[model samples]
Target chain A: MARLVTLVESGGPGVREVASALAPYAGHAQVIGLTGSPGVGKSTTTTALVAAYRREGKKVGVLAIDPSSPFSGGAILGDRIRMQEHATDPGVYIRSMSSRGHLGGLSATTPQAVRVLDGVGCDVILVETVGVGQAEVDIASLADTTLVLLAPGMGDGIQAVKAGILEIADVFVINKADRDGADHTLRDIRSMMALVTREPNEWRQPIVKTVAHKTEGLEELLEAIGKHHSWLAEHGELQRRRTARASAEITAIALGLLRARLDVTDELASAVAAGEMDPYAAADRLLG
Target chain B: MARLVTLVESGGPGVREVASALAPYAGHAQVIGLTGSPGVGKSTTTTALVAAYRREGKKVGVLAIDPSSPFSGGAILGDRIRMQEHATDPGVYIRSMSSRGHLGGLSATTPQAVRVLDGVGCDVILVETVGVGQAEVDIASLADTTLVLLAPGMGDGIQAVKAGILEIADVFVINKADRDGADHTLRDIRSMMALVTREPNEWRQPIVKTVAHKTEGLEELLEAIGKHHSWLAEHGELQRRRTARASAEITAIALGLLRARLDVTDELASAVAAGEMDPYAAADRLLG
Candidate 1:
């Protein structure tokens, strides 16, 4: 599985052949995405959830997508230390992918990585995105269920809504609930969600509180996840979401292939540089 | 000019014809880029540069690339007010571009906007990027001369070094030079630059002090920019940079073209979603 993940990440030659070999046995695992800002206990919650899912006699796969810039220190080292607890378990497989240099970003390799774990024998797959910004939205679109984490005083619900993070939440997990202002945070979130109009049949994202350090509220979080999964299956939303994610993944791969084959010659570049030809015309000529 | 810029920004039909028409005039403008962290007096310095350039009877164009998210009130509103002083000047063409929703980002439209200004007879084009991150690097590649701005006590030279911003500087301007720790900031930047080994004939970035509000050091800043421009021309690096920028621009347009034409059918999406075909294989099939 690690070898397969590495091959996909490298995006080198023979990647398609390997992916084709593994394609037959996938589509069984449930993909759950967890994401939040740093210091939101995402790693801890992911660890806790892994253990909970393991206790259910289920095999699990973990894909931790890191989006930190090359300059900033990434959280993967700390994650590896925490995940060492499950490293000896043959049934649990965990992988970390850095999306720093890839032009297609997460879409190019992440879905392929997920498909690898799904193909192998994992029953539940947890995709935890490290860091903030666009990675959250990407993970949300790619997963069957997305859990957006928040802590007290992180930001009020108004700020989250304005940031457009709330729109990606299938479920909201308020980690560090034992900290001060937890109630205030809950009220803020509730009030913000109230402002958005939804139909009667829409799924209301349940807010679950957890002190991941103490493993408190672990069972309730799992139950909420299970309920959401049930709702997805019942409404045929599962098929729709999986297909949508697949479409995006395929498009990104196609775009990457196109980028690689773009024939930009220095003569053409010189024309554009010399103001004898515009970029739009140069592109047309390149294709021509 | 305003209509042309708007059409390019929209990235709609008639773009190719518009671009082909303007392509012949783009190579004339001496493109200059100025960037810095927020609160570093970038706008004041830019305004000062414009006024000083106008005093020389030079026609100037300003393309302020705003990378701020929608949730945060961008510096554009403030920039427009500062630029109003130049609004009535027939010799100046000033436009603000927001890189918020465009899938191709600044690459898709900024070059076209610059081309329009260049085609319409602007002598000196100032490309000032509002805010930080990748936008700074983007503007650096697009300009003939790049000026990275800093202020006292924002971050020690070490943080700047760590941020990798120093590599993009052709000239450094320490704005707010009247503030305390001005000398310290200069020393920090100097020390950081000194650590990097440069070729004997390579251009050494000169650090200039500026109290932009009072218009102090404006002449020295302009002189340093002129020196760098001369160096770029004499060393054949100006053409290199322009061609490199053009190549990236052309490639972005090509990729945008390929993405638009990718044939991802619903049947193909379903197969990949069901794991009967991997995303990589699906992409190949779509292209094939």
Candidate 2:
């Protein structure tokens, strides 16, 4: 943790030393992914979880990925601001990142940020993405556990299923539970869940309802998270998931570096801009 | 047009061949980019414009990009359905693309699709994006003129300006012009535009009001597009913008290819499930 502090705080010499020193603890912490549509009280639910974990005497790191403000070049900053009540807590560390113009759900800096938090010895790392559409569910691969949040009255379950978020969910939480039609939403989610065949390692997704703003029913949420953790640990999937996540981190870093080196030309950009070249074709020609 | 049709339909030739054939009419057709927040009637405005153009004896191609449903590998397909009313018209060509899990705001096949439409000899291409968040804006760079659309009563101008969409507006349209606060939205947009100075060749971004469903103020909208187009040509900046855009497309394409080549392992899939790595980093690593 000490090694990573300097490494994270200082970018030059400290990074390598910290990377070498904190290499062992990389797989110890629990990484959880939380996602749903925007305005579903993600920030609120995350805050509740952080508080609950802290109450249990665990050090927690909350990483919130906010949509970037193109003009500001920073996070929309709403999620961070909403969680400011924890700003003074020593056991709670919070960081917010913008998508950084990357098209996928997670921010470009997110995996690195997660590694930094893990290296700092946080017992749990809560990674929250800006509510992305179905395609952004890629965040599921990064965590030991994945939670897909949904709300009542958010159109139909068919729309929800078609959204693709339902496919990646290991656990579903119907947040804003106090709203009318919560039961209908819950029933819809269960029916949708029934449509998919689960693997032996995967459990029936537990749907917990919560008015995230009030933090009600968070204990059940934590208990469910604990159950998921136990399931993974006993089956030995936790370590596998972690190692795979580390490998992904390396993969993203490596790809980012390679992309910087390709040095695409003006003619190619013109062709793409003019709609003459698709990204795949451009990629195929540049790399092939 | 024949070359593009062959490139898209046959896929035997590369993008360079299609680009080469389409180079002749680069200056004749003005490409427009339309974007806004989701549910803001971007489709309605785009449909209105396409209809207007076709009525004026201009052949139009509408390239609409929406995210695919990850579960079904199909799109909600709203854009295509919305514009299908004109499907039978020989002067109108409309194609819908799902983001198809790519984060760069375009599906891998978008460029090829555009070429196919262009090759069909459409006088103008109207590209409508899912929304003007980061990925959508990245996709919008594919167009010659980009329009940022906002609806009234969305929020204060502060909320609207801080969004990623406002930065790329070549022109701003307050769609749903019949709404109560449309004038206020226009005033706010003008006030916000006053605070920022654009590049020498860039237009001063006129704010137009349009009731897309009613077809109100579309003439003015067309006039605004025409004015921006003329402004770029008069200053000889049209070619410069087109060149820069093509260069960016090439750069983005090269990076995407490199990412794909390098990270074909199960590592990305696993971490992506965990929510730890974004698709772009994977793409970036491939670029390296």
Q: By DockQ thresholds, what CAPRI class is model 2?
A: acceptable
Q: What is the fnat score of candidate 2?
A: 0.33
TM-score of 1: 0.78
- Going through the candidates in order, what is chain B's TM-score? 0.91, 0.79
Worst 10 residues of 1 chain A by lDDT: A67-76
TM-score of the A chain in candidate 2? Answer: 0.84
lDDT digits (tens) for residues A157-206 of candidate 1: 32233345567788888999999999988887898799889999889999
Q: Each candidate's lDDT (Cα)?
A: 0.79, 0.67
lDDT of 2 by residue, A69-107 (tens): 533433466676788888889998887655554435552
Q: Estimate each model's TM-score.
A: 0.78, 0.85
Q: Write the per-residue lDDT of candidate 2 for residues B68-122, one digit (tens) a residue.
A: 3443333566666777888788888776555554433553445555555655577
Best by DockQ: 1
- Per model, kept true contacts as a fraction are 0.58, 0.33
Regions of model 2 farther than 4 Å from truth? A1-21, A68-75, A101-104, A156-161, A199-201, A266-288, B1-28, B68-73, B101-103, B156-161, B198-202, B263-288
Model 1, span B59-128: residue lDDT tens: 9999876653322323236576777899999998887776543232356668778888888889999988
